[model samples]
Target: MLVFSDLEDQSGIWEETKDLFASDFLYHHKLTEYNDEIYLDALDDIQEHVWNCGGGKITQYGLPPSRDGEKTSNVIRREKSYNKESLQKNVNEKMSLLNDKQRHCYDVVMSRIKNGCIFNSNGIFLNAPGGTGKSFVLNMLLDSVRSQGKIALAVASSGIAATALHGGRTAHNMFKIPLMEYNEIRTCGIKKNSELARLLQMTSLIVWDEVVMANKNTLTALDITLRDILGNNKFMGGIVFVCAGDF
Candidate 1:
């Protein structure tokens, strides 16, 4: 049996060889043991085979043992075959279309998705001067997310603006925002409406446009309602909130 005077000295080689075996020939045989001498002897055998065949020097590392008890020569063939197939598969699925900026945004969004969208900030404020393409950017992002099979909802202070963004009425109409009755204070219970409740629960992205025009009291009320329904599970609503407005 091949042995090593100090196993730790060759630990790196052993790990690399193990990964090679798993990726290249895992189904062929089970690796019962690992020894430095055995690995080195396998390499020498490969070199000898190449020499006998009158080929150039065949330098390689981490050869897998054969399932049929053949020499290490078979291991190299298996690795070549496996690697070629995996490479082709990867190339075939590569992305076809995405501008640089869009790709960057997509990567950021994907990272957030992997981490589960419970962003630290209570909200994200995207600000720009009027007609600075803020709305254009928002619409592009919305389209990208939707293309990925996500649902995005757009709401604005004005019905016309909201309709322009989402192809429908304002968030008030979509979310059923009622006119708050003065003095009653509690009479305007927009949060209690089942429709708004469902939207809040299921929306993956909430784009509140023209936030500057939103009344202070109504904004406060909306925040309170969100806190009550969403609780402390910041991302529980299935949507990340993004507010865009001009100062």
Candidate 2:
């Protein structure tokens, strides 16, 4: 994966076979497990290409056939996948389960999502000990946002923690952050025109679990990438970034 960070250092054979880079990466890492949404966009592109080559017209299932169709489809698919009624019910039921401390954290995060912070913090750091129901509160927050027809991303520093949340993925895979730190320009691999970028742009909230397990450069890279992709100067491109972990 580090080879993706430096084009100049790559060998001549790698440069000639650069078109297979994505396929190689996917084949080796099995990214499809957690990265289905982005891969769906790629499938759309492939189908479109085959249709054009075979002189067949592109058909739309739920998405348009325009240039940005895949991006729109991915966003709409994610938005519609949530059962609003069930999510709202879950949120309501879960709210009562939150203890005083957890309830306060929930309220603070939801409020930040509703009302922008004056200092542009747009970040909520929850420091708690183990067995404090941090995951419970995080799920409630995710449900609360999704219930309102908004997009909330659940990601974690590690895959084990990711499975604890609803529709969670590893933060590195979700953001396309390089596995190994390269140079100082620390930036994620999300192209501005890709569906993944569109997803991030539409994201209202992001819950990152076990955040302390991640390297600082990972977060820095995400910050820089989000600012560029979302075209916002605020922290995390003004997205509600929630970091929860046992410290």
10 residues in a row with least lDDT, candidate 2: 55-64
My TM-score estimates for the predictions, one after another, are 0.49, 0.70
Per-residue CA lDDT of model 2 for 168-231, tens digit only, reads 7899878888766445538998899977888888899999999989888889889999999998
lDDT of 1 by residue, 1-247 (tens): 0231224433356446644534312322123454443354454444445445654343222233323333334322322222234333432344334446545544554445445535454355677688666665565555544445455566788966775563324656555446765233331354544445644554566677888886665555556666566554453243466677898
Question: Counting only residues 3 or more apart in sequence or on different chains, how many pairs clash (N, Cα, C under 3 Å) in candidate 2?
Answer: 0
* Weakest lDDT window of 10 consecutive positions for candidate 1: 75-84
Q: How accurate is candidate 1 locally (lDDT)?
A: 0.50
lDDT score, candidate 2, position 10: 28
